[model samples]
Target chain A: EAGVTQSPRYAVLQEGQAVSFWCDPISGHDTLYWYQQPRDQGPQLLVYFRDEAVIDNSQLPSDRFSAVRPKGTNSTLKIQSAKQGDTATYLCASSSDSYNNQAPLFGEGTRLSVL
Target chain B: GDSVTQTEGLVTLTEGLPVMLNCTYQTIYSNPFLFWYVQHLNESPRLLLKSFTDNKRTEHQGFHATLHKSSSSFHLQKSSAQLSDSALYYCALMRGSALGRLHFGAGTQLIVIP
Candidate 1:
């Protein structure tokens, strides 16, 4: 069974540049999540989806960030105007069931650096 | 809203010594799921242990934690620290609604010295 997969293991961009991070969750998983983890810090939830429907996105920066899971299997998180504070690792995770006691499996994450 | 708090940012211990990392949480929900996640260098975080039952100890991979509703704490502990135990530990909380969202605390870096 393959785990969650994320593309572009790393990304570097200048301030005001836009970037997108892609995530392919585990097969048959119903829930997908995006988290931001700064250096030496824990992962912070940005958004989550359950079968193409966004469950929560209150933490997402509405001004410059957007996420979509059109097919309910793959997800993409976009940053319209990256800032230095956006320098962090973007992690993708998925779970078979949100209501169950099972923990979500995480991806390798995309390390982003904004200059 | 749910939040997790890890008081120690870094903990250093000698090999064969006992290990304890403090974790406390705050939430409006009565039944919250508590989790311990460990992340090695260059690796993503993985679940170490989790429990929703109050006062019931959950053990995995030589580590154990007990969810205490009275104190709102779920501390991670081990009998003996090993060199391989060096990693960043994060305590996370999930609300009782089973929404599968996690609120993580500032990580605690555990360094076991030989």
Candidate 2:
């Protein structure tokens, strides 16, 4: 089975520009998550969903960040007017169920740079 | 607010020695789950172990962590270190709910020198 897959393994955009990263989770996984990992820090959950319904997005910057999992299988995380602070590796992960935080499979992640 | 802490930002140990990584957590939720994740350079973080039962040791890939609810700690430990064990380890905590989102610590970088 294929693990999570992400596009544009590397992305570089100028400040104030916009960029969107896509994620394809593992087959049959019902939970998907988007995380922002700044350098030297752990991956922080920005948003997560179960079967296309967002469970929580409080950590996401309302003004500049948005994530969607329309089909519950693939997700997109978009950054509007990207700032230097938005520069980090965006990771997408998925779990088999919604009950446990057991082990989540991750993609290679999209390394974004705002210059 | 819920949070996780890793005291050691970096640890260097000679190969064949035991490895210990300290992890502590604080959460208001009564039922909390703890986890340990390993991230290699330029790769995404992967789960190393998780805590569901109190005082129950969870082991994976030669790494183990015991969740002590009394102390609210889930520290990762390995019997012996290997060069391959060098990586960044993150401690995480989550509530068993609809959210199920994990709150992670800053992470500890382990370096096993030959």
How high a TM-score does candidate 2 get? 0.93
TM per model?
Answer: 0.93, 0.93
Clashing pairs in 2: none
Instruction: List the lowest-lDDT window of 10 residues for candidate 1 chain B.
Output: B94-103
Residue A79 lDDT, candidate 1, scale 0-100? 99
Among the numbered candidates, top TM-score falls to: 1
lDDT of 2 by residue, A1-108 (tens): 898999989999999999999999998888888999888777888999888999889999989999999877889999989999888999998886656544577899
lDDT of 2 by residue, B1-106 (tens): 8989899999999999999999999988877878898999988988789876899999999999999999999999999999999999989888765447888898
What lDDT score is found at residue A28 in candidate 2? 88
Candidate 1 has a TM-score of 0.93
| Best by the lDDT measure | 1
Least accurate 10 contiguous residues by lDDT in model 2 chain B: B94-103
Q: Report how far off residue A8 is in candidate 2 (Å).
A: 1.6
CA-only RMSD, every prediction: 1.6, 1.7
- What fraction of the real A-B contacts shows up in model 2? 0.78
Model 1: residue B30 alpha-carbon error in angstroms:
1.9
